[model samples]
Target: MKNIMNKTATVMAVHRERYELLAENHMFYGKLKTADFYNVNERVEFPTVGDEVEILFNETGDSLITKVLPRKSVFMRQTMGLPDQAVAANFDYVFITMSLNRDFHISKLERYLTVAWQSGGTPVIVLTKADLCEDRGRYLEQIYEAAPGVDVFCISSLTGEGIPEMEHFFAEGRTMVMLGSSGVGKSSFVNTLMGKEEMATGGIREADAQGRHTTTHRQCMFLPKEIVLPSGERIMGGGRIIDTPGMRKLIVSEVEEGLKSSFEDIEELAACCKFSDCTHKSEPGCAIRRALEDGTLSEKRWKTYQDMLREEAFSKERKKAMMKKIGKARKEIKAKRG
Candidate 1:
């Protein structure tokens, strides 16, 4: 009983897909028995980062994760309009990592934050490699303007400056995952946490690119000691952190509600427009357009909001199709039983 409690406290995991799990942990995996978690195509379940699971093991300490716990929060994105094809779950915070040197994109940050908000996770901006930046404050200001109510932190793994401040997110039981474009310091941050060169260090290209993709899979690490150092100093540890592969494209799901959060100012302005369905571009008495004309609304921000909504609509259609198919299958099963 004491061992169970201790093991539960140290619940960091390295995930292999359900299929891979079968080959690796056969004795414990067999407890699930008879392909229960597998789909019709023989494909098995995959564990995403940030999943806390129940496991059973033999005396050797080898174990099988028998069941997945109820997730406190999930971050999901459907792949290519396939309703069943979804990924990512149970992240408390989403660190939208971007670089100050060259790999910065306001539109990408906006899109990432909207989806992050919709995923039931707080979004935080991580500006990696501050040593490379001549003026980090200017970059942070631009991000704050693009997405209000989000905390942006800058850190340099090379010099270790600004790194300790990042430990705030690792307080106690909370979990944060970093998602970003290739070569944007996600791996560098992970290396900082491991306190060794555990992760590959990528060099930024002279062509304005930041780094190579060092993290290929989503893996969680356990920080046993609170990084809050005692040398008349503070650092944080004893929480979970998952580093995911660099994602070039993170398509939004049914995140239309998130749009308001992302573009709150636009929505607020639209409410005062003379027309209810004011297409803010050309409509008279359009507050949004007025703002655009007078520099209140940046065209780039507005355009990204519009594109996100369109993609969101497509996601809803896919969900509707999935629901309709499920309904039909249920009806047919009932008729056959009758």
Candidate 2:
């Protein structure tokens, strides 16, 4: 290992085995060291987007990523058969984008809210395509119902409405990431924020209103807002924003506290149940069921909570199974070496 003091860089993007980092006022290509790949016993470690890393700069070749610093926050998901993947790390804000037109749904927003809360980032609901929606008030009401105490904005890329409100959040030294499904106008929102068409955007499918992938991978965009005065003076203050590919499937990983926080009303009601083990399904003295039957709770919201709880439980079990398999494989390798 080289003993030279290396410069610190933040990961801009991760493409397969290669990483792109921004350091020393320039962008450089980097590759992980062999030790970073094999230093862990059972867990797999690799640099991801938004990860701050120490790098040994190379004038003629790719820089060597010497160390990955600790992350303050990470956005990740657990799929059924695949290993858990980190979508973004060390972000301060997570914008859960959803177009207010055909792509709007409270259930999906609830799911995204749980993930965002679990990610250790402040969740802000960005309702894009406000120009296309006929009744913006209706959507705002629904959003407030789904995500109480969270900030929600209805923005129009064509009219530039509600775009200025997000300027403070993107100020220098802060990082934010966008998460939404395809066709939710995430790219369009990014373009409008930057005051130019930086990301290529496509139209939604006529039949299903689904969006084709315009951005193929996760990439970080350095957004520095230029505040222009009436006398032609321009002041610049903005931060980093990362745009991730549209996620079609989002599964929560170890989100028990997130679930409780997101559904605090339901949890509070459940705590008053007569039976500690109440299933909330036709059980006597079940507070959840009582609330559902009365006008206190909506059936739809209750169902969404139950569904997410089940998914979280299933994901934890799958993670346990994967760890067991990895442990067995490592033991087998040691035995073979002996």
Candidate 3:
């Protein structure tokens, strides 16, 4: 091992108290410094897959991770009582995969789109299992309606359909993160792209169509420099991809900007309301009300928007309360030390 100090590396996988790192084209194991990360007063940002980090080389054992470098893009989600979880970092595209079978849901797609936009990366909807779905056109229409101005690709990993169209996204230096619920064929998709079974694949329950979690951890995989398709075409660009376990509950927080971007049509209507302070319910000349009544916007879509807004507000309040509690606890600790 080179006797280098403060070397940079990309986090490949994060196990509890351990990390898999790729530095200078070599794979190395790493561990965080307790003083700098674990015993800090301020919250420390833990390194996740796709994160660039500074490390101290250790020829003897695992390298020491000193700091987590700033992220250009990050995907995160938080539950109500738990702390925020960073799913992946430094990704260029979020592949929102949803199978066309029982896994397809417009609301779920919309939710994923909101988080994807908020992550500072382009969101591309990838509808998987095209071979299984008979009414592809209907599902495609629903997707187009739900995600306006977003790119959508319908592909079957089994048959290699629509895989060639996604070749451009695999260009060198680009990184894409796969985001979807369990059983949506994310591993299969990765396997297909790799031209081999790089990740394990699982089947969904036949009765409910709900998928089992084949990928239980988040890890970054480097794409092959050249991938030859079964159809005799070659994908000639190398990139990186981070695959995460399926999130059963994707509770979003601090995604106000993402909401506005995802629901631009609804926001536009609200902007045109006659009263700036209009409640949008009983107010006269309310653009939203008029649109709802005139079939311009579907009621289901409007309800989803309202529900997300409420959820966002609730999450904000919860975070504030949690922070206040932590501050109080810190003050008590300081007093004891004094």
Candidate 4:
């Protein structure tokens, strides 16, 4: 946007090639009148919020996303029914939102942490509706013991409590996405940031989609300036936030490393086991079992780790076998051509 004046000041929000572009200065969105110029992942065609792009602003108030700057980081997940899909392009932090009530589960949080680490962005635990919990003191103690070294915050959108603490995330240039299940207040959190409700939120169904049951499809929204300071942490510029569709099923596709770290306690237990391949259940010298009996580790956490590892391995094998079939088909076609 050469004539937009605030080239450096404007915030660009993108959703699949000008499907809906909100120029911080323009305040008007236009369709992709000429998107053939850009490639699939190029500007305009696959625009993601928080993406710094060069645009051609026309007099009609409609504009085109011309170029996308090199992103410092990218966040993505294995799309449902699709082997690979880049849901979000660039983001620095992943604010994994969850409530304190029936939706609370440590295993599911571990599952989200899988893709969070793989996405190249740091994951932060954001507990919504902290006001609902009766014994806040006991809950924090429990979560802290379960997941260490992870930054976790509890907030209430209604009371505007714990919101200022989220300010660390709203820094000028850094980008963060609120990922969580339906009815978990991701939208409510976004509304507080935008100072208005910009996303339509739904309630959780009788059953979740895949994993944590948060965000169906990921979308972007440029947050209205959350800060107005002469000097502070925000260097990226203003700030952009992405709100994803509630995920019913958070099955991880390719984040084995994340799974390992998420269950480091279990991994550490296997080190002193009698058998290198010990399954940790009913084994003679399984350290995991020792921890279980000693009350050092929870049975649910241990089982969940095993189940996630199994799923990751199975996903890898299934993809490999499918690739082999495709390779054989290509060979047959080449032979016929010869």
Q: How much does each candidate deviate from the true structure in C-alpha RMSD?
A: 5.5, 2.7, 2.0, 6.3
Cα deviation of 13, candidate 2, in Å: 1.4
lDDT of 2: 0.83
**What is the descending lDDT order?**
3, 2, 1, 4
Residues 1-338 of candidate 4 have per-residue lDDT tens digits of 24652232122444444444545554655444355543322323244555555666654766665555666655555554444545566788988888876678777787887778777788898998887877667667767765677899988766667767667677667788877766788887776666665766555554652233344445676665643222222222257788876676776777767766667777788888999988766879888888989988888777777788788887777777766776686678778778
**Candidate 3 per-residue C-alpha lDDT over 1-338 given as tens digits, one digit per residue, 9 for 90 to 100:** 65547689999998887999998889989999878886526898988999999999887899999899999999997966767989999999999999988777899999999999999999999999998989888888888888899999999988888988999999889999999999999988888888888888898889888878889888899888997776767876599888888989888898789999999999999999999999999898999999999999899999999989898898899999998988898888888888
> Candidate 1 on 1-338: residue-level lDDT in tens?
45451111122334454311222323222123235444333344444556545455444545555555566666776666454432456768888888877778888888888878877788988888788899877777778789888888887766667767777787777778877888888877876766656556666577868455666666666554645232224476776677777776887877767787888988899899999988876888989888888998888888888888888788778788877886687678778778
Better by lDDT, candidate 3 or 1: 3
Off by over 4 Å in 1: 1-34, 39-46, 55-66, 81-88, 204-211, 228-234, 318-338
Which candidate comes out best when scored by lDDT?
3
lDDT winner between candidates 2 and 4: 2
lDDT of each: 0.68, 0.83, 0.90, 0.67
Model 2, position 193: C-alpha lDDT score? 63
Report model 4's TM-score to 2 decimal places. Answer: 0.73
**Candidate 3: C-alpha lDDT:** 0.90
Per-residue lDDT of 216 in model 4? 47
Q: Residue by residue across 123-180, what tens digits does model 2's lDDT show?
A: 9989988878888888888788888899988888777677667667868998999999
Residue 45 lDDT in candidate 4: 28
